[model samples]
Target: MEQLFSHGISDSISDSIPQQLYRPEQVRHMEAEAAARAGVDMWTLMQRAGAAGWTCLEQHASAEDQIAVLCGPGNNGGDGYIVAALAKEAGWQVRLFASAEPKTTDAQRALQQWLDADGEVEPLLDWPESEPDWIVDALLGTGIDSDLRGDIRECVEGVNEAKLSVLALDIPTGLHGDTGCALGDAIIADHTVTFVAVKRGLCTGAATAYRGKLWFADLGIQREFRLLTEPAAWHLQQDQLGQWLSPRPAHSHKGQHGHVLIVGGSQGMAGAVRLAGTAALRAGAGKVTVICEPGQEFLVGQQAELMVLGLEPEDPRVAELIEQATVFAMGPGLGRQDWGQRWWNWYLQGLERSDPQLELPTVLDADALNWLAESALELSSRNHWVLTPHPGEASRLLDCDGSDIEANRWLAAQTLQEQFGGVVVLKGAGSLICGSEGTAVSPFGCAAMASAGMGDVLTGMISALMGQAGALNITTEDSVRAAVMAHGLAGEAAAQALRPGTSRGLLASDLFPWIVHWINPNDS
Candidate 1:
């Protein structure tokens, strides 16, 4: 049966937006320049921002509900003042709390306007008596260069204690727009209305926990801003998948799709190779072969579509098979035992000594990665290979602690790419695929893919795509990016369809049909 789950964007919304993502600093300057270019004053843009924020609040809050708008010392506080006045005019019980007076001209003007409109501004030193239905966090914007201390921290603590549904303006106060690190104390918002462009920080790590249900408000300047500054990064949108996917030719045959060879699965590990080989076939590999332990020949043969190659535990024929195949996937379920280690070493030596004339696209994962890391192989020079390492493996390869790798995932991926050269897929919640040019992150996959054997399936899928596309002359980097996106999308589909908390039951084998379904859903 074909898998029904795959991640994709609707046709209508796919082509409308560009994938350009910016750093917080770049976005702020871009917003200012864009506002100017639009013949709108900066204050006018701030007003629109506040209005947008108020509109968001109205959408989520009831008309009679009491709300507190927390303001800081800068323009972010100015936005709070505007929201407070808007809420007051709308007949809602609203109170404005600020740690310090507004300092910027637009902020001062906004404060005067709020006071003129009979809005009450109170110091946030003491907690409000009555708990409100909502809290507007405008304490800090993207300009937070220093840590949050003194009254701001106290204010944040009070808001948390109030147990109100906090809606942060622009960004959650205290999140470094560039690093996504919290500045001492930060507000945990239920919803955040970011302007212009989404900051990269919000999509990764602890930031994802704080910024809930993120909404992007262009504030009517995205286009102008995009023209002025190049995006440092971008989020993967669903619609762009088709562009990277290979279109089938009317007269195309199995041979045209290219062949994939999977080399792994030591004794008692046949399931990993089976998952990978079947995944390759499902991913549209014209031919799939699994070179596993001779003891597991029957297990590999159970999959009718996959060709089982019964090789001795440490056969040199494995290298020959690699030479003949269009792509190779190694390390899934590969044990570190004496037999497995000997096979691994032979495979490595074969790869190193292979005819320079025969360069096949390869994927190295699991034990393959561990062996290479332990051996200190110069991986960067092997441009034909792709390394898929989860955080632990990546830490081992980089000779760093796992926590260090998790602390700065983006930089870690970048460092891996710089050091290792080939496309590196740093798999985790927000899986990052980094190449020489730049990095792309897929925030789509869920905890469902955390189950056993998922990585093995990913290895095969990537290998297959590389093989299929490389035969057509697609760049290795582009192929890796597309494969990573597709793999995550399939995992997301499985997560959505299966029972909650049952992701552990989602075998890597289940993703193959979903991959096909996603690439061409309407097909028979």
Candidate 2:
């Protein structure tokens, strides 16, 4: 935490968000208690919040800029009242729109302060006569659990229609603070400056699209609050991942690092496994081997650096492969055909030696997920596996529709873990890694991953990280989270590099160089 009173805050507010994510309910439960403990009154806290928001706006707009301030009935509205007063005092052309009278004492006090300052409040019917340069959405805070109402919905629509640069306070109206799902119409702000704590919804689902650029202002009460509950998830950033990254020693050899075997590429669909193999190698796997179906060896082994072999029951090397590799990535081009199924069963059986506990780092993705669903293989406990599923594949695994998996991605990831007994990565806008460490979400998503082979690349990255985690001196949980951040960062990089003019269109292979670059940025 840095000093909130100094210009150091300017950089902090514009450039970064807090590391912890809190649910709205959680913040509500703690705010008053936290404020009281800090000897700060509700009015004082509201003043700080209002000041923080106003400071953010002032950076983008000057006294000459025309601005509109929207206020509701709650404390959020109080913040708006203060902002209006501040703007009015600063000689900016400002308009205040009130949906309802101040309902709380703090809000009433702030409204009276604005009135004393000779700030005029207008009805929330339409925009001001002069087109405002910006709009501040302080209408609804984080507590909204359901859909917007008649007047609120209309006001939200008006704000959206205004289309001017808008700064949303706390959260945008109509966006559920916990789930990030827009109940009806949500405010599409040009910037959102969240206060105190970040809500889980802002980092996941549909919320990511409307959230624009996010900034955080903690309101200078860092030590006053302690987390009473665990966060819904942790958000990982690209640059922060470097702390977990260490360069390979010059004396290090292939034997010291980990060997990763990619099992898949059944029959005609060899591209997927090939991508996964190359990704594993790029991601720092000491040695990568592709176990493809018969006659597909050459296709999967396109790179001389990777060893490719077809699975043969008669081949001794084929039987020993599962036991020999440090980690297994089972999926990608794997079909639900007999050949794929046989290999899946063979690997599972091969790993169950003297130890009763099923402990092997494996990532199940693509067609491997389909086979798991088809067979309905029930495991008694966790087998040290990671299941990477996009919404469609998640539905198949959960025996539900794609909509159900997406409806609540967090719940879906949790339910999958309970059923399948492993870490579950629900791949989407906010890719989640659910394990014993709880769920960590990477809210940063790249449009490039929308392409076909993106999942394959992710699978390879996760598997390779898991394979080499020992040499890296990182935990599986940390490795998984780091891999996710790296993958998304790579995708975002590829998207930017491939389409600097406009962001669209990407192949799976586009991320290969990025994977290598992120793992070893010194080379780049």
Candidate 3:
């Protein structure tokens, strides 16, 4: 199967906020309110909604195809009746399977309309007797509050057994619209055409399997409706990154950018430091210096344009260099040896005593993050820092099992941010960047970036962005937002250039050219 990323969706469409995300109850209320505001009858919205659904069906299926419309007792079933009527009118073979009689006036009227059109209406238990090209699930919508059992369970099982393409209305029946939790046996849809607003459950958790090929259609709601409700979550998109990236000027010089100092690389681990230093430079840092073990200085200088500083594993001069740099990238190859521990402790102490107004933004990764977690150092005091951790590292930092972290990546990222008092980048499939006020999930990037040294490059790239002269002038939130987006975009470009299967071999060093390429794609 072709990866979804290969679909080549441009940044423009991806940048648009998903039409609207609403809780199940909230959507029901919105429908009532929108109906009142439209100065039309309550049935008008349902009619329009069903019409929109039928339009989608027309586009998705052919006129000669046979479709089974499954209806329940509520307004959702009313929509299904309307869909059946439309499909019949379009000269398509359509059958109706009702789980129960219409309970609402609109639904009753729709059922009468279907009868008036001479459509087939039979019990849902008869689904096995009929053969249809597609199954339209309208058995339940956002209003489902109880577990699906009895006939509904058997109906769902029968639908699945048929192995026909299914289209769910609003939401897959028996899945919580607010929590993404499945209620008994939920219908697994191949396509879900949601109306008015998107349900939060559709985007996360186990709901991913049930709500496939998600599509949202707004029933002409005004944009001002958004002002009435607070957004519970946000999606990170590529164009949003433009707000954070610094637009370059023709006269801009390297000195006009900011300086970054990368501190790490214990004995025999020079490649990590080289990767970090080169990444920082590639990410647009004007000046970068690598302060590593004396034995690794030659290797650092050979691979990167960065100025390499030869220092003993526990050198005190490292503090002076750190104080001078606009941003610090720490960890990478920093080992767990006693010398590395001593240097790490001294670095934290330096951060504690550093001039409050002159403190530089620091990014902790790999060993530095592990040391912080082990020492239980009060990280909240170091407000200008970012922590990048994979699942194992995050589990240690949060004192939780790795399974706990994977179970809810968003919650884990938030917990780490609240505990550590810095931007927390939870590196994994669907990487999350959480801060004090908000969280952003990178929809790009793949398992291709799963190789060693990737986190080192990420730390360096973020540090460079934070240290950039333009970034220093922005708000802290803005700086962190830009850095996170840039890092993901660079990773995405690199992964795309080297096909998906070949991504594991991708090194942190490979990200540099791609970072430069993405930051200035037109720069030749």
Candidate 4:
């Protein structure tokens, strides 16, 4: 029987996971040369990739289990054929389906090898009539940039419709290796075994769902390939916490940890500001001040530690708080009403008038972002700020549709960072952070984070982290990436605590305790 649980890439392979990600074209251009330099031929590399994929399959399948391999016309198909030949030798029932005869010499040789192994091939006009334990997707490789068409599209659809466990070779068929977008449709694999370096496209965007439980095999070419190429982005991992955050000094006082000012919380939406303020405190900000709309002081300050000042947009106290704040996190519960607008203008004007050298780090989110999208005010690159925008808010900031942002999250993130300066945290599943240091992708976060006010908590976490960036002896980019990973991990932890192994009905505030736990990386 097939394994019921996901045993993600084994520990031995886990250590080999590549942090540096390359674009698909870069991987393609360098792989052949790298393989040759590593004293391996293309066929030899193909055999290594097939062997790694078979190992993953072995983890899922028992002896004599049925397996179906869908081979394409290219080298990706060659990988599928090699896996089929191995399964056949291992005493498994193998049914290989080909969309067309192998197109490349390497693939053709692989097809002949499968034939030599006594493996029969069938046309992939439809999914195999006999339901198999697993489907191997090798229909398309990383070169795909447009929508899938004709028989291949049908084949991809059939694989998805069949709803069998799928082990995708390289990338799930129909996913654009550079953009992570589905070409018309893509195979939704339960496990994806990718070769060489992890592709940048597989790290973000719509590819998140299609590429499940990603496993990588360097195929003995990573060192050579890495030497010849520059990473498109670095993958963010939980282990980065220790590298980015240090334990507070034992003699630390509230004044030393930095103050985080949360400027928002208009009217009935005090919960948003409250969440942000509380999260800031929980994340180890020494002091948290909320300059909320007048009459919201009680609601925003319900958390006793928060210094809540209900001040009008024009209040002098607001300026005082701004001057004292180590970092400003704007936008939570900042509605688009006149009150919100006044506060937005007030904050920007204060920044404009302040000495450029003393520019406070700011994080803009929610309605604050919406206001920025609508504003004609020019923001120079010198402004030290981080913009945290969900896809919808990002669409506004970029003047594109949300679908467009989701279609290419990496592009959207880079564009935002280039335009906005400081850093850009494009929040969502597999959030992308583009900062002055470069781009990074956070693989944390789960479905439970889809609820409301989640972004608010993230805003506070980012702000709190930024406040301590100096003491942590890290850059603003480092703080932002760490906060993103922590936020996602906290969300996952909260969901698990609510109901182990499930992600549902998790409130944003539920992340508070987990936030405390993750923020203190040295504690664990």
Candidate 5:
């Protein structure tokens, strides 16, 4: 086997895994699953991993160029040894640097294979005459703890300083595959050729920055691995939305799509609810009503699709609208003052009318969450609601610092769900959706969504989905998840509209057409 592979990376590789994302422990366990299956073993998987990395390198680097291979003590490092030997055979200048001796038996066997191929492993103390054109980071993979220290820390720093293009084998060394958080300092790769399933962390937050262009190669265990375990979190894709969407027949009417009552857009903040209402229309809401302060009705009137109704806080129509509403999208422009405060109190106070079976699926956003946080209530009753809050709002709701909320977004989402019943969409770089079903993290989105009215747009989108899904008797979490996926894709499309270098000026309205594309499968 060693003699046959000494010629360099061959085209004999496995299928690609683009959809499924896994936690570190999950992927490791799946490796065992793959090894346990017939005609494959741990060493075979490791060799395939090495070949995968080598193929990625050949695609990115010149054949005549020098390559710096950083190897560790674990099987991750063993993969490095094989990659080094393969690169050398492929006729590149392969300079192998070893931080430690091979630890596990499989790693030991892989090390011997490199020696048989006459490849030498050098210590970092010795410097090569010329800098390598590419660096292969095979050190310290997913198994490492949060504390990135000792020789590994120094090695990571060296790689980052070299600032050269790097191809990280499964994940960039020092990045917690489970959390995608950099445990201290991590390698910044130009591209990461990951094996098996994708580590969930690579799709969001700080971990996302280090992995430049991610490509996946499943190593022939895609089906077996999937059969062995479920994913920790789903990376939302456009395709997933199709199952969640119920097609409307030619006989379908506007009343059947479900009505959406968006309650907010207080005085001086009318555009907030307008954006939400527009988003609901784009998301296939049969009818959207924007109920705001008396002077704010004109704000929603600009959009001819939305029906704007202005009312005083104590108006009888408030309860009437709530009764007639299919779903309520609350808190887009809701302020904490008298006008916004009164309406919030009305919704909270009025929710008591419905039993759980007939309760409205409400999307609680912006100041509605603030009102909840300020009320000192445990939210013991509102089981049919979705709270969408950014990190700052999440901090307020959870009573923790914003930093704590940002530290572990999934944990924050779970804590919020525990505190406030119903779905909690912890919106940010990687927005998390936590509910009774489980948690789903939004994998696609841009920093562009950080602009002023983005959340308002999402509020409308998800609420419309929830209302529409209610007509079809679909699950609330499913509707919410689909909305999040659609919003993210829309945001990405809006961002792409800008010139290549810049990611600015993407407005909430820019996502309207894209939302239509996501909702309608035929259009997509």
Candidate 6:
């Protein structure tokens, strides 16, 4: 959204990486031509890439450090050769391994340069007896997506067994450059220094395990590269918060912020609606009302701020409150029983009868998404809602297996938004938000977020932000992004405080204070 670093960028992209994310093919097709337009050739760009890789290697190594470099047969291998030669010149003990002899002219020249520098290459099968301080993976950069095979697969296996900290250049070998899925096997790197541009693969899906602590080096062609192509998606940034939220006017009242109506908290699952309601309050909703089963009021309304009305589907008060609500957050603990089903139908009928131009802003999550999938009701013309679904829910909505959704999350998110009008938040490791404004990925969440009730909290946060969109002076898409970012930041903060380096015991409610902290971007 707001590109604070957009202005006054330094010559090197490393100083300020652009938020734009590109598919690997975009970089591959445009990079050479873009470099030429910028008055640089492909070989020179390779050298700069090698130098950048050398710099990253230096961060994890020192002179005399034993570093093993794995080179491929193409340009990726050429970059590896250049890095090995520079390491040798810097007095580092370099052990270079190649799956095959350099094939391309540029790679052939690079190999000769390394030979002239007196560096020897070993066969791929020669596993080093001695462990090195760091292993440099320069093999298979954005080249393959089918599956790993032959010596390359064996090499990937060997490197993984070594378990040394790895610095992967461009991308981890075997990771699909576009889908982020492993071809067959992928190198697990501790740090990956991607060159030219940030590949969409590096930020989400299975790549999360193989590509760790990502670093980007634009290789001086980013300006030209960006001019050559448009980004397919955006990597979420904290600075984007400033673009979505601001301080409230000093004389503002609670009613001015907007009201959020939270539906569904069946018998034993009243906690879901409670969590959603409380999260709405914590996230700055002016007022929150939880509509649950007739007897769950005490459990749902225990939080003083939440006005809980435990009523049946036919209760007239339900219609009255629904009419007054500025936004609706449906699902959460809404069960699949007759009671929950009746409420679902009630809401659907209201939406069906409402004017298309003035449809209330809504958030569909948890059991609500499940019910929506079951109903198969098409609301493709309404664009005032948000659907937040996990892989399972998305799979249900798309009529596919959950693994298919995870295999290519970008496609899943896009398809969901296309099939179901309005924003779609595909929640997981690299949560993706797709809408009319294009897709954005929030890479800020933690594994601790794997627990239950997290999605409910996110539903509440989204609803709160949506209700406040008018006052915040941002679009519905901006509101969704802001809520997702804040939710992720809160989870990260809570996980760090509770378990430091591991994600073990963080709870859904633990994020309340942090949600308040992040929701108010100006204060933080």
Q: Report the Cα RMSD per candidate.
A: 6.8, 3.4, 6.3, 3.6, 2.8, 4.5
What are the per-residue Cα lDDT tens digits for candidate 2 across 96-160? Answer: 98999999999999899888877888887665564788999899998777888888888788778
* Regions of model 6 farther than 4 Å from truth: 1-17, 354-358, 377-381
Point out the higher-scoring one by TM-score: 3 or 4: 4
lDDT of 3 by residue, 83-144 (tens): 88878876788999999999999989888878877887999988766788899998998887
lDDT of 6 by residue, 1-524 (tens): 11111112211325344589999999989999998998988887877777778877877678867888989999998989888888887788888889998889988888888888888888877746546777889888997868899988988898898788888889999998788988878999998888889999888878898997888888777898999899999999898897788988899899988899988899999999999999999999999988998888899878998998888878878767877899988898999988799988886776777744237899999888888897666544458889999999999999999999988999999999998889999999889999999999998888888898899899999999998999998998999999999999999998998878867778999999999889988973
TM-score of each: 0.89, 0.92, 0.79, 0.95, 0.92, 0.95
Error of 6 at 437 (Å): 0.3
Of the candidates numbered 1 and 3, which has the greater TM-score value?
1
Q: What TM-score does model 5 achieve against the real structure?
A: 0.92
- Model 1 per-residue lDDT tens digits across residues 227-304: 898877667766656666746768888887778887777888888888888878777789998887767889877998
Tell me the spans in candidate 4 whose CA falls farther than 4 Å from its real position.
1-16, 351-358
Evaluate model 1: give its lDDT.
0.77
lDDT of 4 by residue, 146-184 (tens): 889999998888878888899998899999998888989
Q: Where is the poorest 10-residue window by lDDT in model 5?
A: 6-15
The lDDT per prediction is 0.77, 0.80, 0.74, 0.85, 0.80, 0.86
Model 3 clash pairs are none
